[model samples]
Target: MNLLNTLKICVIAFLFTSLLNTTTQAQITPVLTHDDALKMILASKKHAELSDVLVNIAIVDAGANLKAFIRMDDSYLGSIDVAIKKAKTARYFNIDTGKLGELTQPGGIIYNIEHSNGGLITFPGGVPIKNKNGKIIGAIGVSGGTIEQDKSIALAGAKSLLN
Candidate 1:
Protein backbone atom coordinates (compact mmCIF):
# COMPACT_ATOMS: atom_id res chain seq x y z
CA MET A 1 0.00 0.00 0.00
CA ASN A 2 2.83 2.37 0.86
CA LEU A 3 4.52 1.78 -2.51
CA LEU A 4 1.26 2.40 -4.32
CA ASN A 5 0.71 5.65 -2.40
CA THR A 6 4.20 6.84 -3.25
CA LEU A 7 3.66 6.13 -6.94
CA LYS A 8 0.40 8.07 -6.90
CA ILE A 9 2.09 11.07 -5.29
CA CYS A 10 4.81 11.05 -7.92
CA VAL A 11 2.28 11.01 -10.74
CA ILE A 12 0.34 13.87 -9.19
CA ALA A 13 3.52 15.96 -8.82
CA PHE A 14 4.48 15.34 -12.44
CA LEU A 15 1.06 16.41 -13.62
CA PHE A 16 1.18 19.57 -11.55
CA THR A 17 4.63 20.48 -12.85
CA SER A 18 3.52 19.98 -16.43
CA LEU A 19 0.51 22.20 -15.88
CA LEU A 20 2.68 24.95 -14.38
CA ASN A 21 5.07 24.91 -17.32
CA THR A 22 2.25 25.20 -19.82
CA THR A 23 0.72 28.12 -17.93
CA THR A 24 4.04 29.97 -17.74
CA GLN A 25 4.68 29.53 -21.45
CA ALA A 26 1.22 30.75 -22.36
CA GLN A 27 1.57 33.90 -20.30
CA ILE A 28 4.82 35.00 -21.87
CA THR A 29 4.48 37.97 -24.25
CA PRO A 30 6.25 38.51 -27.53
CA VAL A 31 9.88 39.57 -27.28
CA LEU A 32 12.06 41.54 -29.65
CA THR A 33 14.07 39.42 -32.05
CA HIS A 34 17.83 39.34 -32.61
CA ASP A 35 17.34 40.87 -36.06
CA ASP A 36 15.42 43.72 -34.52
CA ALA A 37 18.23 44.29 -32.04
CA LEU A 38 20.76 44.40 -34.88
CA LYS A 39 18.74 46.99 -36.77
CA MET A 40 18.69 49.19 -33.70
CA ILE A 41 22.42 48.82 -33.21
CA LEU A 42 23.19 49.68 -36.82
CA ALA A 43 21.03 52.78 -36.78
CA SER A 44 22.48 53.93 -33.50
CA LYS A 45 26.03 53.39 -34.71
CA LYS A 46 25.33 55.40 -37.82
CA HIS A 47 24.06 58.29 -35.78
CA ALA A 48 27.08 58.16 -33.51
CA GLU A 49 29.36 58.12 -36.51
CA LEU A 50 27.67 61.21 -37.87
CA SER A 51 28.37 62.92 -34.56
CA ASP A 52 32.04 61.85 -34.72
CA VAL A 53 31.79 59.91 -31.49
CA LEU A 54 32.33 56.30 -30.57
CA VAL A 55 29.83 54.78 -28.20
CA ASN A 56 28.65 51.70 -26.42
CA ILE A 57 25.09 50.70 -27.10
CA ALA A 58 22.74 48.38 -25.25
CA ILE A 59 19.30 47.06 -25.98
CA VAL A 60 16.81 45.61 -23.53
CA ASP A 61 13.53 43.82 -24.13
CA ALA A 62 10.17 44.56 -22.60
CA GLY A 63 11.03 42.60 -19.48
CA ALA A 64 13.95 44.94 -18.79
CA ASN A 65 16.45 42.23 -19.72
CA LEU A 66 19.53 42.97 -21.80
CA LYS A 67 19.00 41.59 -25.28
CA ALA A 68 21.99 42.91 -27.21
CA PHE A 69 25.02 45.18 -26.89
CA ILE A 70 27.74 46.71 -29.02
CA ARG A 71 30.87 48.66 -28.14
CA MET A 72 32.54 50.72 -30.81
CA ASP A 73 36.30 50.71 -31.20
CA ASP A 74 37.91 53.12 -28.71
CA SER A 75 34.71 53.44 -26.77
CA TYR A 76 35.15 53.98 -23.07
CA LEU A 77 35.15 50.65 -21.22
CA GLY A 78 33.31 52.12 -18.27
CA SER A 79 30.45 53.13 -20.54
CA ILE A 80 29.58 49.49 -21.27
CA ASP A 81 27.91 49.03 -17.93
CA VAL A 82 26.41 52.47 -18.11
CA ALA A 83 24.83 51.69 -21.45
CA ILE A 84 23.27 48.50 -20.15
CA LYS A 85 21.91 50.18 -17.05
CA LYS A 86 20.47 52.98 -19.11
CA ALA A 87 18.63 50.49 -21.31
CA LYS A 88 17.28 48.67 -18.30
CA THR A 89 16.20 51.86 -16.60
CA ALA A 90 14.24 52.96 -19.64
CA ARG A 91 12.58 49.57 -20.03
CA TYR A 92 11.83 49.20 -16.34
CA PHE A 93 10.04 52.50 -16.05
CA ASN A 94 8.72 52.59 -19.63
CA ILE A 95 10.23 56.05 -19.95
CA ASP A 96 13.36 57.45 -21.51
CA THR A 97 16.29 57.61 -19.11
CA GLY A 98 16.74 61.33 -19.85
CA LYS A 99 13.21 62.09 -18.74
CA LEU A 100 13.62 59.82 -15.79
CA GLY A 101 16.74 61.71 -14.81
CA GLU A 102 14.78 64.89 -14.64
CA LEU A 103 12.41 63.33 -12.14
CA THR A 104 15.29 61.94 -10.09
CA GLN A 105 16.87 65.32 -9.57
CA PRO A 106 17.07 66.65 -6.04
CA GLY A 107 13.72 67.85 -4.67
CA GLY A 108 11.91 66.46 -7.68
CA ILE A 109 9.42 63.61 -7.70
CA ILE A 110 10.97 60.13 -7.38
CA TYR A 111 14.24 61.57 -6.22
CA ASN A 112 16.94 59.01 -5.54
CA ILE A 113 15.15 56.40 -7.60
CA GLU A 114 18.52 55.67 -9.16
CA HIS A 115 19.51 54.02 -5.90
CA SER A 116 16.81 51.44 -6.48
CA ASN A 117 16.46 48.87 -9.32
CA GLY A 118 19.98 47.54 -8.77
CA GLY A 119 21.41 50.92 -9.77
CA LEU A 120 19.92 52.95 -12.62
CA ILE A 121 21.45 55.37 -15.08
CA THR A 122 19.61 58.58 -14.45
CA PHE A 123 21.04 60.44 -17.40
CA PRO A 124 20.51 60.95 -21.09
CA GLY A 125 21.06 58.33 -23.84
CA GLY A 126 18.23 55.97 -23.13
CA VAL A 127 15.07 55.81 -25.24
CA PRO A 128 12.09 53.50 -25.13
CA ILE A 129 10.94 51.56 -28.20
CA LYS A 130 7.22 51.37 -28.69
CA ASN A 131 5.05 49.42 -31.09
CA LYS A 132 2.50 51.06 -33.37
CA ASN A 133 -0.12 50.28 -30.72
CA GLY A 134 1.85 52.47 -28.30
CA LYS A 135 2.98 49.50 -26.28
CA ILE A 136 6.56 49.68 -25.08
CA ILE A 137 8.54 46.86 -26.70
CA GLY A 138 12.08 47.59 -25.63
CA ALA A 139 14.68 50.30 -25.06
CA ILE A 140 18.06 51.44 -26.35
CA GLY A 141 20.97 53.19 -24.70
CA VAL A 142 24.16 54.77 -25.95
CA SER A 143 27.16 55.97 -23.97
CA GLY A 144 30.78 57.05 -24.43
CA GLY A 145 29.82 60.46 -25.82
CA THR A 146 28.31 63.73 -24.70
CA ILE A 147 24.83 63.35 -23.27
CA GLU A 148 23.23 65.03 -26.29
CA GLN A 149 25.17 62.91 -28.74
CA ASP A 150 24.34 59.77 -26.87
CA LYS A 151 20.68 60.74 -26.81
CA SER A 152 20.69 61.33 -30.53
CA ILE A 153 22.16 57.89 -31.14
CA ALA A 154 19.73 56.22 -28.82
CA LEU A 155 16.80 57.96 -30.44
CA ALA A 156 17.87 56.68 -33.83
CA GLY A 157 17.97 53.16 -32.50
CA ALA A 158 14.61 53.50 -30.77
CA LYS A 159 13.01 54.56 -34.03
CA SER A 160 14.49 51.82 -36.19
CA LEU A 161 11.36 49.73 -36.01
CA LEU A 162 9.30 52.46 -37.63
CA ASN A 163 11.04 51.97 -40.92
Candidate 2:
Protein backbone atom coordinates (compact mmCIF):
# COMPACT_ATOMS: atom_id res chain seq x y z
CA MET A 1 0.00 0.00 0.00
CA ASN A 2 2.84 2.39 0.83
CA LEU A 3 4.54 1.70 -2.54
CA LEU A 4 1.25 2.24 -4.40
CA ASN A 5 0.68 5.53 -2.55
CA THR A 6 4.21 6.68 -3.45
CA LEU A 7 3.60 5.86 -7.11
CA LYS A 8 0.39 7.90 -7.17
CA ILE A 9 2.10 10.89 -5.54
CA CYS A 10 4.94 10.74 -8.10
CA VAL A 11 2.50 10.70 -11.01
CA ILE A 12 0.57 13.66 -9.58
CA ALA A 13 3.79 15.60 -9.05
CA PHE A 14 4.86 14.97 -12.64
CA LEU A 15 1.53 16.17 -14.03
CA PHE A 16 1.61 19.30 -11.87
CA THR A 17 5.14 20.16 -12.98
CA SER A 18 4.20 19.68 -16.63
CA LEU A 19 1.23 21.99 -16.29
CA LEU A 20 3.36 24.69 -14.67
CA ASN A 21 5.96 24.50 -17.40
CA THR A 22 3.37 24.85 -20.12
CA THR A 23 1.79 27.83 -18.41
CA THR A 24 5.09 29.57 -17.94
CA GLN A 25 6.06 29.03 -21.59
CA ALA A 26 2.76 30.40 -22.79
CA GLN A 27 3.16 33.57 -20.73
CA ILE A 28 6.83 34.22 -21.47
CA THR A 29 7.50 36.92 -24.04
CA PRO A 30 10.54 36.85 -26.27
CA VAL A 31 13.01 39.67 -26.02
CA LEU A 32 13.67 42.05 -28.90
CA THR A 33 16.77 41.23 -30.89
CA HIS A 34 19.31 43.50 -32.54
CA ASP A 35 17.46 43.36 -35.84
CA ASP A 36 14.31 44.58 -34.11
CA ALA A 37 16.18 47.52 -32.65
CA LEU A 38 17.54 48.53 -36.06
CA LYS A 39 14.11 48.34 -37.65
CA MET A 40 12.66 50.59 -34.97
CA ILE A 41 15.39 53.15 -35.51
CA LEU A 42 14.80 53.16 -39.23
CA ALA A 43 11.07 53.62 -38.78
CA SER A 44 11.65 56.59 -36.50
CA LYS A 45 14.04 58.18 -38.97
CA LYS A 46 11.30 58.41 -41.58
CA HIS A 47 9.41 60.79 -39.31
CA ALA A 48 12.37 63.11 -38.78
CA GLU A 49 14.88 64.95 -40.95
CA LEU A 50 17.80 62.67 -40.37
CA SER A 51 20.11 64.44 -42.77
CA ASP A 52 19.35 67.88 -41.40
CA VAL A 53 19.84 67.15 -37.74
CA LEU A 54 23.38 67.38 -36.46
CA VAL A 55 23.09 64.55 -33.99
CA ASN A 56 24.32 61.11 -33.14
CA ILE A 57 22.09 58.10 -32.47
CA ALA A 58 23.39 55.06 -30.71
CA ILE A 59 21.67 51.75 -30.12
CA VAL A 60 23.03 49.32 -27.59
CA ASP A 61 22.12 45.84 -26.51
CA ALA A 62 21.13 44.82 -22.99
CA GLY A 63 24.80 44.15 -22.29
CA ALA A 64 25.64 47.67 -23.50
CA ASN A 65 27.31 46.51 -26.68
CA LEU A 66 26.99 48.89 -29.57
CA LYS A 67 24.69 47.28 -32.08
CA ALA A 68 24.08 50.27 -34.32
CA PHE A 69 25.35 53.87 -34.22
CA ILE A 70 24.81 56.80 -36.58
CA ARG A 71 26.39 60.26 -36.54
CA MET A 72 25.14 62.78 -39.03
CA ASP A 73 27.50 65.18 -40.73
CA ASP A 74 28.42 68.34 -38.75
CA SER A 75 27.25 66.82 -35.46
CA TYR A 76 29.17 67.80 -32.39
CA LEU A 77 32.21 65.66 -31.72
CA GLY A 78 31.20 65.18 -28.12
CA SER A 79 27.67 64.09 -28.97
CA ILE A 80 28.84 60.63 -29.96
CA ASP A 81 30.30 59.96 -26.55
CA VAL A 82 27.32 61.47 -24.82
CA ALA A 83 24.92 59.43 -26.93
CA ILE A 84 26.78 56.24 -26.08
CA LYS A 85 26.67 57.12 -22.40
CA LYS A 86 22.98 57.78 -22.54
CA ALA A 87 22.35 54.50 -24.32
CA LYS A 88 24.33 52.66 -21.68
CA THR A 89 22.40 54.41 -18.95
CA ALA A 90 19.09 53.41 -20.48
CA ARG A 91 20.21 49.84 -21.00
CA TYR A 92 21.40 49.44 -17.43
CA PHE A 93 18.47 51.15 -15.75
CA ASN A 94 15.69 49.98 -18.08
CA ILE A 95 14.29 53.54 -17.82
CA ASP A 96 14.96 56.90 -19.38
CA THR A 97 18.08 58.48 -17.97
CA GLY A 98 16.38 61.87 -18.24
CA LYS A 99 14.39 60.96 -15.15
CA LEU A 100 17.54 60.11 -13.25
CA GLY A 101 17.89 63.63 -11.98
CA GLU A 102 14.48 63.50 -10.34
CA LEU A 103 14.77 59.90 -9.28
CA THR A 104 18.22 60.54 -7.83
CA GLN A 105 17.22 63.28 -5.49
CA PRO A 106 18.53 63.33 -1.91
CA GLY A 107 16.10 60.58 -0.91
CA GLY A 108 16.02 58.46 -4.08
CA ILE A 109 17.80 55.18 -4.82
CA ILE A 110 18.82 56.38 -8.27
CA TYR A 111 20.60 59.30 -6.66
CA ASN A 112 23.76 57.29 -6.26
CA ILE A 113 23.34 55.22 -9.40
CA GLU A 114 25.10 57.89 -11.41
CA HIS A 115 28.23 57.49 -9.35
CA SER A 116 28.01 53.72 -9.66
CA ASN A 117 28.03 53.66 -13.47
CA GLY A 118 31.00 55.64 -14.67
CA GLY A 119 29.66 55.91 -18.24
CA LEU A 120 26.02 56.53 -17.37
CA ILE A 121 24.62 59.76 -18.81
CA THR A 122 21.66 61.29 -17.03
CA PHE A 123 20.04 63.20 -19.81
CA PRO A 124 16.82 63.43 -21.83
CA GLY A 125 17.96 61.76 -25.03
CA GLY A 126 18.14 58.16 -23.92
CA VAL A 127 15.13 55.88 -24.24
CA PRO A 128 14.84 52.28 -23.16
CA ILE A 129 13.39 49.86 -25.72
CA LYS A 130 11.09 47.29 -24.18
CA ASN A 131 9.74 44.04 -25.56
CA LYS A 132 6.01 43.48 -26.07
CA ASN A 133 5.85 42.22 -22.51
CA GLY A 134 7.45 45.46 -21.33
CA LYS A 135 10.83 43.97 -20.59
CA ILE A 136 13.70 46.27 -21.45
CA ILE A 137 15.93 44.62 -24.02
CA GLY A 138 17.86 47.54 -25.43
CA ALA A 139 18.16 51.34 -25.55
CA ILE A 140 18.63 54.20 -28.00
CA GLY A 141 20.33 57.56 -27.46
CA VAL A 142 20.27 60.79 -29.41
CA SER A 143 22.40 63.91 -29.02
CA GLY A 144 23.48 67.11 -30.86
CA GLY A 145 20.10 68.82 -30.46
CA THR A 146 18.25 70.59 -27.71
CA ILE A 147 17.29 68.37 -24.78
CA GLU A 148 13.65 68.60 -25.69
CA GLN A 149 14.35 67.89 -29.34
CA ASP A 150 16.51 64.98 -28.40
CA LYS A 151 13.78 63.60 -26.19
CA SER A 152 11.29 63.99 -28.98
CA ILE A 153 13.45 62.13 -31.40
CA ALA A 154 14.07 59.37 -28.92
CA LEU A 155 10.37 59.03 -28.30
CA ALA A 156 9.72 58.88 -31.99
CA GLY A 157 12.24 56.10 -32.24
CA ALA A 158 10.70 54.09 -29.39
CA LYS A 159 7.16 54.68 -30.51
CA SER A 160 7.90 53.12 -33.87
CA LEU A 161 8.23 49.76 -32.22
CA LEU A 162 4.77 49.78 -30.67
CA ASN A 163 2.96 51.57 -33.44
Candidate 3:
Protein backbone atom coordinates (compact mmCIF):
# COMPACT_ATOMS: atom_id res chain seq x y z
CA MET A 1 0.00 0.00 0.00
CA ASN A 2 2.87 2.39 0.86
CA LEU A 3 4.54 1.75 -2.53
CA LEU A 4 1.29 2.40 -4.35
CA ASN A 5 0.86 5.73 -2.57
CA THR A 6 4.47 6.73 -3.38
CA LEU A 7 4.01 5.89 -7.06
CA LYS A 8 0.84 7.95 -7.25
CA ILE A 9 2.60 10.92 -5.64
CA CYS A 10 5.44 10.68 -8.14
CA VAL A 11 3.03 10.65 -11.10
CA ILE A 12 1.22 13.68 -9.76
CA ALA A 13 4.50 15.55 -9.31
CA PHE A 14 5.58 14.75 -12.85
CA LEU A 15 2.29 15.97 -14.30
CA PHE A 16 2.51 19.21 -12.36
CA THR A 17 6.07 19.79 -13.54
CA SER A 18 5.12 19.21 -17.16
CA LEU A 19 2.29 21.70 -17.01
CA LEU A 20 4.53 24.37 -15.55
CA ASN A 21 7.14 23.84 -18.26
CA THR A 22 4.57 24.02 -21.01
CA THR A 23 3.16 27.25 -19.62
CA THR A 24 6.61 28.81 -19.36
CA GLN A 25 7.49 27.83 -22.91
CA ALA A 26 4.30 29.33 -24.27
CA GLN A 27 4.94 32.60 -22.42
CA ILE A 28 8.49 32.90 -23.68
CA THR A 29 7.68 32.19 -27.31
CA PRO A 30 5.90 35.30 -28.45
CA VAL A 31 3.69 35.33 -31.51
CA LEU A 32 4.56 37.43 -34.56
CA THR A 33 1.55 38.75 -36.43
CA HIS A 34 1.11 39.99 -40.00
CA ASP A 35 0.74 43.53 -38.73
CA ASP A 36 4.26 43.36 -37.32
CA ALA A 37 5.67 42.28 -40.70
CA LEU A 38 3.88 45.10 -42.52
CA LYS A 39 5.22 47.62 -40.07
CA MET A 40 8.78 46.58 -40.82
CA ILE A 41 8.25 46.71 -44.55
CA LEU A 42 6.70 50.16 -44.45
CA ALA A 43 9.53 51.51 -42.31
CA SER A 44 12.14 50.08 -44.66
CA LYS A 45 10.36 51.43 -47.72
CA LYS A 46 10.15 54.86 -46.20
CA HIS A 47 13.86 54.90 -45.48
CA ALA A 48 14.73 53.67 -48.94
CA GLU A 49 12.54 56.38 -50.47
CA LEU A 50 14.22 59.05 -48.37
CA SER A 51 17.63 57.86 -49.54
CA ASP A 52 16.53 57.81 -53.17
CA VAL A 53 17.40 54.17 -53.38
CA LEU A 54 15.27 51.54 -55.03
CA VAL A 55 15.49 48.26 -53.20
CA ASN A 56 14.00 44.92 -52.31
CA ILE A 57 13.16 44.29 -48.70
CA ALA A 58 12.57 40.88 -47.17
CA ILE A 59 11.52 39.75 -43.73
CA VAL A 60 11.97 36.32 -42.15
CA ASP A 61 10.38 34.98 -39.04
CA ALA A 62 12.30 33.61 -36.07
CA GLY A 63 12.18 30.23 -37.74
CA ALA A 64 14.13 31.69 -40.68
CA ASN A 65 11.12 31.47 -42.95
CA LEU A 66 10.11 34.28 -45.34
CA LYS A 67 7.27 36.21 -43.76
CA ALA A 68 7.11 39.33 -45.88
CA PHE A 69 8.72 40.93 -48.90
CA ILE A 70 8.58 44.22 -50.80
CA ARG A 71 10.32 45.16 -54.02
CA MET A 72 10.37 48.81 -54.86
CA ASP A 73 9.22 49.76 -58.38
CA ASP A 74 12.07 49.30 -60.89
CA SER A 75 14.30 47.75 -58.30
CA TYR A 76 16.96 45.38 -59.55
CA LEU A 77 15.46 42.07 -60.55
CA GLY A 78 18.43 40.14 -59.20
CA SER A 79 18.11 41.76 -55.79
CA ILE A 80 15.02 39.76 -54.93
CA ASP A 81 17.06 36.65 -54.17
CA VAL A 82 19.75 38.60 -52.41
CA ALA A 83 17.22 40.31 -50.18
CA ILE A 84 15.56 37.05 -49.20
CA LYS A 85 18.84 35.33 -48.48
CA LYS A 86 19.95 38.22 -46.33
CA ALA A 87 16.86 37.89 -44.15
CA LYS A 88 17.28 34.14 -43.87
CA THR A 89 20.98 34.47 -43.14
CA ALA A 90 20.33 36.98 -40.37
CA ARG A 91 17.52 34.99 -38.79
CA TYR A 92 19.29 31.64 -39.10
CA PHE A 93 22.29 32.87 -37.18
CA ASN A 94 20.45 35.41 -35.08
CA ILE A 95 23.05 38.04 -35.95
CA ASP A 96 23.32 40.96 -38.34
CA THR A 97 24.59 39.83 -41.75
CA GLY A 98 27.41 42.39 -41.80
CA LYS A 99 28.77 41.10 -38.54
CA LEU A 100 28.45 37.57 -39.84
CA GLY A 101 30.36 38.63 -42.93
CA GLU A 102 33.29 39.65 -40.80
CA LEU A 103 33.50 36.22 -39.25
CA THR A 104 33.39 34.53 -42.66
CA GLN A 105 36.35 36.45 -44.06
CA PRO A 106 39.49 34.55 -45.04
CA GLY A 107 41.25 33.04 -41.99
CA GLY A 108 38.40 34.28 -39.82
CA ILE A 109 36.71 32.10 -37.19
CA ILE A 110 33.92 31.01 -39.50
CA TYR A 111 35.58 31.16 -42.88
CA ASN A 112 33.36 30.17 -45.80
CA ILE A 113 30.33 29.79 -43.59
CA GLU A 114 28.32 31.57 -46.24
CA HIS A 115 29.02 28.75 -48.65
CA SER A 116 26.91 26.55 -46.37
CA ASN A 117 23.16 26.73 -45.55
CA GLY A 118 22.34 26.51 -49.29
CA GLY A 119 24.15 29.86 -49.73
CA LEU A 120 24.00 32.79 -47.34
CA ILE A 121 24.76 36.47 -47.94
CA THR A 122 27.24 37.41 -45.27
CA PHE A 123 27.37 41.05 -46.27
CA PRO A 124 25.69 44.14 -44.92
CA GLY A 125 21.95 44.95 -45.20
CA GLY A 126 20.64 42.11 -43.02
CA VAL A 127 19.48 43.12 -39.57
CA PRO A 128 17.90 41.02 -36.86
CA ILE A 129 14.48 42.25 -35.82
CA LYS A 130 14.09 42.19 -32.09
CA ASN A 131 11.07 42.83 -29.92
CA LYS A 132 10.90 45.52 -27.25
CA ASN A 133 12.41 43.06 -24.80
CA GLY A 134 15.41 42.66 -27.09
CA LYS A 135 14.42 39.17 -28.14
CA ILE A 136 15.13 38.44 -31.78
CA ILE A 137 11.77 37.74 -33.40
CA GLY A 138 12.74 38.00 -37.03
CA ALA A 139 15.06 39.78 -39.47
CA ILE A 140 15.03 42.31 -42.29
CA GLY A 141 17.12 42.37 -45.46
CA VAL A 142 17.43 45.16 -48.02
CA SER A 143 19.15 45.01 -51.39
CA GLY A 144 19.65 46.92 -54.70
CA GLY A 145 21.61 49.74 -53.09
CA THR A 146 25.16 50.19 -51.89
CA ILE A 147 26.15 48.15 -48.87
CA GLU A 148 25.91 51.19 -46.61
CA GLN A 149 22.54 52.19 -47.92
CA ASP A 150 21.18 48.68 -47.56
CA LYS A 151 22.47 48.39 -44.04
CA SER A 152 20.97 51.73 -43.05
CA ILE A 153 17.65 50.83 -44.60
CA ALA A 154 17.61 47.44 -42.93
CA LEU A 155 18.40 49.09 -39.62
CA ALA A 156 15.50 51.44 -40.09
CA GLY A 157 13.20 48.48 -40.58
CA ALA A 158 14.44 46.68 -37.49
CA LYS A 159 14.11 49.84 -35.46
CA SER A 160 10.45 50.11 -36.34
CA LEU A 161 9.63 47.45 -33.79
CA LEU A 162 11.00 49.66 -31.08
CA ASN A 163 9.17 52.76 -32.24
Worst 10 residues of 2 by lDDT: 43-52
RMSD (Cα, Å) of model 1: 9.1
Number of the top-ranking candidate, with TM-score as the measure:
3
Positional deviation of residue 90's Cα in model 3 after best superposition, in angstroms: 0.6
Q: Which of candidates 1 and 3 is the stronger one according to lDDT?
A: 3
- lDDT for each of the candidates? 0.89, 0.77, 0.91
Residue 126 of model 3 has an lDDT of 94
Residue 100 error for model 1, in Å? 1.0
**TM-score for predicted model 3 compared with the true structure:** 0.81
Residues 1-163, candidate 1, lDDT per residue (tens digit)? 6999999999999999999988865554346778889999999998888889999999999888888999999999999999999999988888878889998888999999989988999899998887645668899988999999999999998787767
- TM-score for each predicted model, relative to the true structure: 0.79, 0.71, 0.81
Compared with the true structure, what per-residue lDDT tens digits does model 2 show for residues 1-163?
6999999999999999999988875554356566667776675454447535667888887787888877777879999899888888888878887887578777886666677767578879998877656777778888888888777787787767665
Q: How would the candidate models be sorted by lDDT, starting from the highest? A: 3, 1, 2
Pitting candidate 2 against candidate 3, the one with the higher lDDT is 3
TM-score of 1: 0.79
For residue 2, model 3's alpha carbon misses the true position, in angstroms, by 39
Clashing pairs in 3: none
Give the C-alpha lDDT of model 3: 0.91
User: Model 3: runs farther than 4 Å from truth?
Assistant: 1-29
